[model samples]
Target: MGRRSVLPALCLLLLLAWGQPGAAQAAPADPPRAPSTVYAASPALAPGAITVHPYGQLQQSDSLDDYDTSPAASIADPLEPWNRFWFHFNDIFYLYVAKPAYNAWVFVTPHQLRSGLKNFFSNALFPMRFVNNILQFRFLEAGVEFGRFFINTTTTLGFADVAKGKKTIVPVDPTGEDFGQTLGRWGIGHGFYVVWPFIGPSSVRDSVGRVGDCFTDPFFYVYPWELATSSELALRFNALGDVLPLYEDLNSAAVDPYIAMREAYINFRNSQVKH
Candidate 1:
């Protein structure tokens, strides 16, 4: 059936699924103490540092393998001169531009404004991801899909690319799982932590997946000149506000933000796989 025809049915199914007796139960909270095995091997760390690194060397090795396998990393191999140039550019944009914007969003905005903006952005993307979530059978995919679709559609006119049949553009469905989740389903464990300049920290697999996602984003579909600059800024501001809580939680809890982020990424990715 066509998407329009199928959407209503999918929404009904989701509503029913969510109503299941146990569906409302919250997920187990992250353990207060790190796993004992982690502490046993790294005796130098204080008690609080135990959960900081879950898989240890094994995780790091696995991340390296994913980095080696990721097509984006291959194309932008750190050793290549052109790639290095681009990486530097990415760093400048992220550190000087995006990071500052994100910081402003967190610290400068009034709480009510931040909350309202986040809701506004999230509400805009809800319809698209809600439909896609059913199609892909992954709710997290639906959630990320919502964020991506909102960003592209509002800021860059990305939805037009999908309408035009640009297969390179990421699909708008939330049900579609990310590459790292796909890797995990294939039984590959998450490995070491690496942070990219603009994109933030992600394993080799997730980093590659983000590139694939960017291609599908609506931003590529819009002529940069055609999109309103103010609208774009608003979207970024809203996006940062929405994720500020997650950033704060990560910083407050972990001794190493990189490792904490990696674990959170993996945990979120794994949740997608199950859905």
Candidate 2:
């Protein structure tokens, strides 16, 4: 594949590795985990904020659309001009494109099949969890991740997760780690906030770290190229079903969706590193 063709696969891997809460669940995506105390209030009105008013006119009017032609008023996200532009791009894409596609996928696909896809995708990315655990020197956690993969892969072909059982001898840790957290654990700073097109919230450190995590994704190997391509697509489209609704809820509740997502994401990433 050419460079352009490879981009989608990498984005897909990062999306999977980016694993939000309730990502594995069937859709009508769960309510967002309650925002942390700090994020419970609205951010100050500022340029480079990622706002999505429910009103269509505001999205098209001077309030939001000016980001394309104007510089962000603050250094909080000096990249805000471009970031706001992409934020709008992603918002429109999700509403008109991704959300509709997700609805159609849900309409035709049985819940059981979707659930299997979820399990299989999670199983396929075992290396992300395994390697990150090792990076953090959590050898025992790494071992549990290792055993969980073999048991799930061999006995049930990843359709069932026996490791999650209440009485199971080997307990699995569902709090999967990623390259971003690994970097943070090693004292890397979150350089600045970024709103990636289609991919959503991230920072400079996490963005670079995301690319690294993609190399650990099993979908890039194991299966034939064509099979690998289709598998990754299926996994992400399925994930979209569980992600878009949460986006809708967050946007509706926030005074400015952009700042809400930015603050929440930063707080969440910091919490992940501290843990």
Candidate 3:
């Protein structure tokens, strides 16, 4: 079916799924935690209900393999009550809404097609990365982005990355640069914490930076609101595939998934700023 038909069906399915009761399964054994970081999930949430490692931080689609729940630095959370409220809000949305819908999309779509969609998204978002690198006067990194963009675009039409591994030349994408990082590099501190529903962990500065990053993305300008919104969401969802299980492990282990994600996000962004 065409995406237009599929999308409405998907939304209807999401509502229906959310209304239905979550199935009961025999509780599984506790998953092992990584040595470097202990990922934590909300105690309120059942271990196997649904796994969602969401974004803005999670949204960026950069490497999340190194998320450390216990971090050395943290942001001001004067908005803790507000943050926690939405944390749970997003938690419920993920538990019932996102996973089921995403699974159906996965079922209908081929594996190769999913992989290509992920690659295509990363490839398409080069402008935001390239510009932020330039804004920070990281010309060398910007040049590298340009090189990778040209090679990847020409070689695969943005469907696959032909840059590195085996017969390698260009390095992997030097991700984590953005308007938020640019603002941080320009001496902007984490101006308190804010957790948005669906978008997850963020700060006042970073939240504003999200608006800045939006301008850098071409998809924001796409005509017909439905296609633009769907394309953007497809980018986030496709990028989320790898990190879902990561959160599953972490969320299962955590006492408070919200705090775990918050601390890690601070540390993650702090590390990015220095680079």
Candidate 4:
């Protein structure tokens, strides 16, 4: 059977594991121990500021479409070498590539240019998603498209699944509003934060969303040769340019840097689930 058929079973296993007698016994009786507030050591702020920062932080953190789960989780739990390795690489990418490129684009005041290019790409793929959205009647596609129009247009490009059309597989938009919200509606609580290597801050629910999104992304629809040669490069360039502001905001507002990021990520995922 296809792996897709097994996923429901896998999720059921996770739910069962969480409620199993032995597992419940192992868990603390009172509740899952909340992470310590010691990390809040940065000078106390007004309640309003705290609220705003967390909100801004969540907004900023959600903008990073990439994964970075280790740094956030490491704040509470010890890090494994693999996690560290990925963290180091993430740092390198941020410091050398992402940061510099962002500065260049912002300093050059190319927001409109970048935005237009993103729109062009998105409009090009509009037909595909329009067809998919109509066929499936997934209202989340409308939300995803709305987010693309207002919050960030790059997401629209990410939603395209050209390869699925090529393969005659009906691909769902993983990054669509329905995916994350669906998980929340189904009673899947957001788990602890994790910093995936190339991806940034995400919780268990969002992580699952990421996997599903990848499967449905148009990039996966392309053949390996076409993807590696030019399509990937174009997409990467557009993505970096588009997401520059989000990275800047996250770096600027983070209190514990990564912890603030983790909390914000969890909060955003939870919000998405609620909506």
- TM-scores vs. true structure, each candidate: 0.42, 0.73, 0.70, 0.52
**Cα lDDT, model 4, residue 165:** 27
Reference-based TM-score, model 4: 0.52
Error of 3 at 51 (Å): 19
For model 2, how does the per-residue alpha-carbon lDDT over 120-209 read when each residue is reduced to its tens digit? 777877899889878777676678778888988998898766666544333434647788778777777777667887678788888888
| Model 1 C-alpha lDDT per residue in residues 1-275, reported as the tens digit of each score | 55333332322211000000111122223333321222233212222221212211112222322222221111112223333344456546645676687787668777666655544444443443355344345555455555556565675455222222324233332233333444444454444334554445455555544443333333323444225223434665556533444445554443443334444554444444443
Candidate 3 lDDT over residue span 97-176, tens digit each: 77777788788989889988877877777888888877877676667777778988999988887753433233323343
Off by over 4 Å in 1: 1-192, 225-234
Alpha carbon lDDT at 152, candidate 4? 34
Score candidate 3 by lDDT.
0.58
The lDDT per prediction is 0.39, 0.62, 0.58, 0.41
The collision pairs in model 1 are 59-191, 60-192, 63-191, 141-174, 142-174, 158-218, 169-216, 170-216
- Candidate 1 has an lDDT of 0.39
10 residues in a row with least lDDT, candidate 4: 15-24
In model 3, pairs of residues that clash are: 40-254, 41-254, 55-59, 55-199, 56-59
Clashes of each: 8, 1, 5, 14
